[model samples]
Target: MIFGKKRFPGAVADFEKAVRAQDGDAAQEAFARLHRAAAKAGDGELREAGPRLATLLPSVPHGPRAAVAVVIGACVERGADVSACAPGILAGARETFALAADFCARWADTGGGELPDPDDELTEEIIERAGYEPAVGWFTLPQWEMASVAVLNDPAVRRESAGTAELLALVERVAEASDHEFRCLAYALRVLDDEPLVVLHRDTGTGYALRMSGIGDNFQLHTLLAGVLIGGKHLPGQAPSPQEIAVCRDAPGQVETVGSFNLVGPDGTWIFNEGTPTDIPVIDGARLLVLDPPPYRRAWPAGRFFPGMRGDLVLDRVLDAAETAAWFAKVQPAKR
Candidate 1:
């Protein structure tokens, strides 16, 4: 009971007491004490104290989690300069994110599980929706995907980094934080437009295979979506096409499979594929057509888990819209 504050064994210690306490009052009191302690202590200087403070609060049911989010959100709202508050706010937010990730892993389909799998960290749905399969026999996305998603979802992070001159800084931060090559994210956001992989058969008038390596197993795929431009060079003896999907052999000895893609038309409707085979041929010196990833379908209708959302939940909603899809599919004369 140093200075009227009883330090617990660990973060788990405080959390368990909160969970097991017979009365809500005891838990609330413990949480308030811990939250204040953590906030006042700032960060890094506290040794293991940070985890201990984080664990004591009611993370679920929106009590402590909401409080932490509120505090960080307040810092942003109060015009806290990026130089002063950004690091601590990001640290606090990361702590909260860790807690939430733990909470999510403890529950199974019914929302109770011990912890999220360090392995099997991704779902087939994410893969299909994102338009590229994980490396052979792998699950979850690579580091670059995680970085991209985080940047897209967090408004504060984006607001701070949004600028004309700081593009290189933004890319460097993404590379450092995501454990991926800065060039990878840059290509995805700018030239490639986040389609995972793209294919083209134009430049050399033959099929060209661009292999992606490093960060994990090698993956090869291709696409040209709206506003995305790529040089279509083909492999030897392979003809080029303006409106066709290219199926390529992965590495060696691996069976070739057609990748599912979405062709979003200007109209509200969408075109999708299940990776079934098509008997399309190629011609020389014509337009180039990309095999975009397929449109998303809601496994459980929206508002089931995500409230106020109608239809299905698409990860990249704005970029995935039918208008965007159609524009990408629309044939335009290649810029000379």
Candidate 2:
């Protein structure tokens, strides 16, 4: 039941007024000002909550203040009415909807749905109706609450899709990586193997080409389409354009994508002109894995301009420091 109020007055109030009203420039400015208040005492909750809620609202449904306050309380101590807040969390952030739905539905608690049998086509029907189908009716039914139920209950997704060649081999290798309960694009990380992979798809004037980086750690090239990246951008916050979104669809019957890369060795390097397989060194050792697509054949280079996005730069930064790797690999691993 928390309400958002104008904490700042005077000219600040007037500016905030414009911002909340959806005045683009003012909204951006207001966001900055509000962001500063995020860390202050009694403000930390709202501060953290605002950004997350911004993503959820208009897509899910709920208030930001109430949601953040509940999360804050949950983080500090127990006995919080999380079930009450679960809907708010889901209502606000789509990225968290799966988890949030699990929470509000009280999946793990006593009197919870626990899980339904796989033959439960009822759950499948719910998913079909609610999951990415071109309408919003599913979110309104009991289905949204049970969405994650079908997700974890279905043994099919966990068993892994098999029986292809090159890409399939690469995907199976992903099994070697860390395991987290995967879902939707989050599962993409398992194949792509990391947090979100950032790609650059700029208009290279030759139509448009794409390239991603994760080289030395992953000895494979992630050739992708501009549409894939752009598609993810349409999720309510940003409209991923050809420049922002790049396609990484799987090739055939296999669910593996072209941009998928699994760590095979340390010599991961980009090969320019596949005509001869030239080595493009992993940017910053292995911190950068580059994905370069074939040239777009339009407007001279007028098809797709391949803009290379900085893939997991963290690994490159890590690989750059031999000492850091040694410390963790030797010093830490022995203790564990």
Candidate 3:
């Protein structure tokens, strides 16, 4: 519309200018405008701008990179072909914008639900050779169990037993590597036989939890948290189910039940309570609360929703506030 170019093109120009100026705030605002412009642009305009927008991703500042990636994801969601952006996205898979990059990659791969049939001739041949019948649609329970056990028992997989000391060391390493931007709180739960539970509270106000079950070594720990940080899932585990709480006001009685949690990564697997709620010892824990940042900031969308309970379900009313706070005060920081 301006200078013979459409709104999208104009917005792209503004974004490019902001990037050139190395202005983080301006870049963020420009990216937002670009997203709006893309939404209003026609399908033809989107297709034409897709590749150009992708090329700008690498030049975006770290603080605003995720925002830019979201714009690209929006374009892809609108049916724009931005497959060319995959390489840059994969390059930054470990960076802060990982979740958005993952969303873009997934959208490109599935075209938002058009995936290739998994039960093709090659798959059937492999199934026959493995002495397993080809499943018509989904994996049967027995098949799934067998596969899971096989993966668990694989020789290449790495597993380690970690105690309190090793856990502290791992947390310190992750914090140092992320320059303390990756803030989280760890707790040692007595109910789970003293397993360490890590709750990552991001600057975006999004939170995620991982229970360290003395599984894999530090590398696995990094990978697990990294996937969680970006709101993506590179592992498999049981999804979280709601727990039932009972209250009897007249009788002045209350019953608390055990909840389930699981995480399976390349190196290790963790299963807690097996997705069932049962009567057990009261759930009490000492806090290893490390960094507590204000819970208000940018909103980052998860590329793949990890199977876990909401923060309130995982923590609220379960832990004694006074006791936990006292324990947190007594805890010392892990030595570097």
Query: What's the lDDT for all of these models?
Result: 0.30, 0.28, 0.35
**lDDT winner among the candidates?**
3
Sorted on TM-score, best first, the list reads 3, 1, 2
lDDT of 3: 0.35
Residue lDDT tens for model 1, 222-308: 221211223222123222132221212111122222223333222322323211111111222222233333334212110111011
Residue 68 in candidate 1, Cα distance off native in Å: 6.4
Q: Write the per-residue lDDT of candidate 3 for residues 113-150, one digit (tens) a residue.
A: 43223223325543343223222111221122121222
Candidate 3: segments with Cα more than 4 A from true spot: 1-6, 97-336
- Give candidate 2 regions above 4 Å deviation: 1-91, 94-105, 111-113, 116-182, 187-336
TM-score of each: 0.24, 0.22, 0.29
Q: What TM-score would you give candidate 2 relative to the actual structure? A: 0.22
